[model samples]
Target: MSAEIWTGVRERVLALAESPGVEKVFGFPYGGTPLEDPLTEEELADLERYCGVRLPDEYRDFLLHVGAGGAGPTYGVFPVRRDADGAWQWHGDGGDMTLPKRLAEPFRQHVNPEELDALLADQPDEEAYEDIDDYDTANDAWEERLFATLWSDDHTVGAICLCHLGCAQRQWLVVSGPERGRMWDDARCDYVDLEPLGVTFAQWYLNWLTEAEKTAGTVSPSETR
Candidate 1:
């Protein structure tokens, strides 16, 4: 999509933030409608280079024309910024989960529910151990193995954590492989397999915007399609 697609999106979001009862939105209070400055071409290039993956087209354009992040779905999109040391990093709650180095790798496209169930079932139980120390050791090992099997960086390759939905749940935007450009739900923290949201980055953001506007009474029902 052209940069024009993002034109006025920032203003539209600002409008939503100011609309009546915007605070009633689930994450509006925490986000407070803060919007970062849009990235320049140089900054966008640097981000893509550092991440080793080109962002989804819609997201890339949003970064260029709208804002790098801020005032988005849930608690708002995680913002990427250059630190004092001039290294680009995404900053927000759960933002560290987005491993920049792993963006080049292809994202795992499939999840086996039975295998996940089996893994959860195999969790070490303290009562099964004869001694507390044994239980601690065994539990640690099991936890490590569990993370390696399902929650490792390898499992989330080519995806970036975009927003958190309270608790430990977060949303990811796939940046590589066949699923590139789609959003995925990360419920592995709850021992659930990842699932697609069946929406592209733009669609996801726009849907949230429409809902937010409606909640704020800024959009009439007839205006939405």
Candidate 2:
């Protein structure tokens, strides 16, 4: 993730975005316009301060050197956005994932299904409820909390949606904690599991680009898994 490596990544990504064949494959409209410029240092700083954490080094290099958005990968890399409340969030629409407050915390590398089971253990099982309606009411509340914990923004929490892989799938970059600088493929739609890709942002970006170069238009969301 050296600056030199990122400089090379920036050039290759820029080249790919500008390539005519890429346009034919991904079909993302650029309106025959050029890519945007790198984000200002001040802008990056303000984002970090608002999020209460520094971005991973490779990603920081990317936004500072590479274009802020509009290039690379399947659906193209998404730009960072701030809402009126100054909350840092990304709404890819292709896949909607939150940028959580715990993004500043060290990320969790893996999620344990057993942990969720433990949470359910805190509540009485359906058998514990004599009345079916009562059981439904109690379980609904617990189920809501269960889903929230599963998707929380701490360790094992998703950081950012780096790109939309299409078909309601996404490639996420880990920003907080143990997985802090790695890439993950979220391919739950095909009954496939969430899979890890490269360890850093640079590697992940290059891997996607390389895939596209080798076989244009063959790239799909499931490929990342």
Candidate 3:
């Protein structure tokens, strides 16, 4: 990937905040603040040391040169901060999928995006069966499994939820394991399942910046592809 990608992302990211219907609750009156300044080298080191893993360089550069946390894709990027006890942390989804765990452990890549739709596409519609109880027993097992794993932290074991895209969709950036720097869409809650976008941190961030421009008038929707 071109190293200059982050610079282009910065320009496009500013345009994103102006898009309509984006509920930016942080960094102003009422919500917890978002970071504005670039993180210092020492600060980055402190963060990595606390997390027990080094962040992807592109992501680190984005955090150091572009912006720390506030003002990013959809609901905005998760902020990195230190807690009251002085433990460095990533402030997002306090579930088991998140912090205070072993980060070097490889993340399990379970679902392939291409097969995701087909996996549930065959699910029988409720009205297909005359008896609801019959459908519940025979037709609903796979659907039930989908829901079970949807909320399971194991699905996104080594990734952090970066931003929520509404309608039960969210973007996650891997921090450790085999996909240490890739991004994915976690839509398991809605049965869409996990889909890897095959983009790195810089490209993923660029994806949103570009999408925001397409949404706004500054750039045409077709230009993004």
Candidate 4:
């Protein structure tokens, strides 16, 4: 069933690639409609072993059947590659956030609203500081501390940063706990909490593909010529 689903997906991707003026689509400069090669079973096994957890079923199947990653939602999926020493790692902007060692742990979904509110409320007030230089120093320090707390890895355990959406935005795929197999929007870089997209890997990817095609259709045919 997974293979069949991937086949249909590949077909859609191909169609999208063949669309007129595909080069003008958003994120085309980065991905160019090319998918990386699929991973072998041995490679997939090694990746799972290294992470100490089995990947979600649909994603695992995608790595096995479809290309490992490429030309996906937004800027495209981050591609996993092996080094000269045969160590596997995902490569792309913001990919480092996916801690493989923590993949087996349950994703921590509980964010303390009170704590977050308090942190925001603690922002340094420029009006309170009489000296301009002193206000700058205090503001910078406050921002540093606030960002550190909000971007802590404790909030994203058991997940992988799947793709970057530019402007410091990204998405994650949970591999363990109740949210396993679902996608989450990572807007923490914008000081927002992560929100579950409420869609599985396949659904998320396919939806993007559909939207991409629709975007392509909106281009005037004369423009391509």
Every candidate's CA RMSD: 2.8, 6.6, 6.6, 4.4
In model 3, the clashing pairs are 106-177
Which residue window of length 10 is worst by lDDT in model 4?
Answer: 216-225
On residues 29-109, what C-alpha lDDT tens digit does candidate 1 reach at each position? 353445778999999998888887888889999999878888888888999887777667777778888888788898885
List the candidate 3 regions with Cα displacement exceeding 4 Å. Answer: 1-4, 8-35, 92-97, 111-148, 214-225
For model 1, the superposed segments whose C-alpha errors exceed 4 Å read: 29-33, 110-112, 220-225
Arranged by lDDT, best first: 1, 4, 2, 3
Say which prediction, candidate 1 or candidate 4, comes out ahead on lDDT. Answer: 1
For candidate 4, report its TM-score: 0.87
lDDT string for model 2 (123-154, tens) is 75888889999999988888676656554444
* Residues 1-225 of candidate 4: C-alpha lDDT, one tens digit per residue: 656667656545655677785776554325344777789999999999888999998998888877788888888888887778876677888888888888999996656778777888999899999999999999999888777777878888899998988889999999999999999998877777889998999899877776777778743232345
Please list the C-alpha lDDT of all candidates, in the order they appear: 0.81, 0.65, 0.65, 0.81
lDDT of 4: 0.81
Q: List the residue pairs that clash in candidate 4.
A: none
- Candidate 3 C-alpha lDDT tens digits along 61-91: 8877777776665666767776688686565
Candidate 2 worst ten-residue window by lDDT: 215-224
Could you tell me which residue pairs clash in candidate 1?
none
